[model samples]
Target: MPALTVLTGAATAAYSAALVARPQLLQRPAGLARNRDARTLTRLVGVRDTAIGLAMVLAPAGPARRAAVGARVASDWGDAAVLGVALRGRGTWGKTVGFAALWGAVCLAALRYDER
Candidate 1:
């Protein structure tokens, strides 16, 4: 369980670093044409994801397991979103199944340390 938690946390942090980078990359390209508020919002989302990821790895317990729990949940959330966008409506149902599987994996990691 501890190993699972550490592995997930490390992976989560790495994922977030990528998430944060994508928007910054866009800010120079097509992002130059995008609405300022929308761009800011996108960057904020990435920052939030990155923080949650770092938190999970650095502080996994005490006061609140919420951050750690949320870290994995956030990763799963992004996975589902990507799958949804990639597939669109007619094919989205398959993406949903994939999301469910991903969620299940996250849940297993969460449950492993969910002493509460």
Candidate 2:
């Protein structure tokens, strides 16, 4: 479970880095307008993910790590909600929301195995 948490955190951090570096990666896929405001928002999300991911990766086992995992799950749900609404009816909407929700579920499941 700890290994899974680390792996998930690493993946999240890497993806967030990509998003921060290339907002178009997110915008183009989601059918969002490739504008400055969109880019800024994407970068902000990236930053948030980065922080959460780092916490998951670096926090020790037990309460601190569990809290980080909780934060990550929350973030994923938040993304699912915001993106689901923003991209509703678009082809990418399902994919985006599904991914977020699925990832959140994975993290939620991991919580059971988290050392308390």
Candidate 3:
């Protein structure tokens, strides 16, 4: 379970880094307009993800770690809701929403094994 948590965190952190470094990675695929505002928003989301991922990875086993994982799960769900509405009728809507919801589920399931 710890290993699973660590792996998930690492993956999130890496993806966040990529998003921060290249906003186009998310913008182009999500069919969002490529503009300064979009890039800024994307990078902000990246920063948020990075912080949450690091918290999950670095927090010790127990409630603190569990909370961190919970945050990640919550964040994903929020993303799904926001993106689902924003991307409605777009080609990338399904892909974006599906990924967010699925990832949120995965993170939520991991809570079962959290050493509380």
Ranking by lDDT: 3, 2, 1
Which regions of candidate 1 are displaced past 4 Å? 24-41, 60-63, 74-104, 107-116
Query: In lDDT terms, how accurate is model 1?
Result: 0.56
lDDT of 3 at 53: 84
Model 2 lDDT per residue over 1-114, tens place: 346787788788888889999989878877888889989999999999988888888988778878999999999998899888988899989888998999988876766655
C-alpha positional error of residue 79 in candidate 1 after TM-score superposition, expressed in Å: 7.9
For this target, which candidate reaches the highest lDDT against the unseen true structure?
3
The CA lDDT at 83 in model 3 is 98
Name every residue pair that clashes in candidate 1: none
Compared with the true structure, model 3 gives a TM-score of: 0.92
lDDT of 2: 0.85
Clashing pairs in 2: none
lDDT of 3 by residue, 95-114 (tens): 98999899878876765655
Predicted structure with the largest TM-score when compared to the true one: 3
Worst 10 residues of 1 by lDDT: 24-33
| Model with the higher lDDT, candidate 1 or 2 | 2
Which is better, 2 or 3, measured by lDDT?
3
Q: Write down the worst ten-residue block by lDDT for model 3.
A: 107-116
TM-score of each: 0.52, 0.91, 0.92
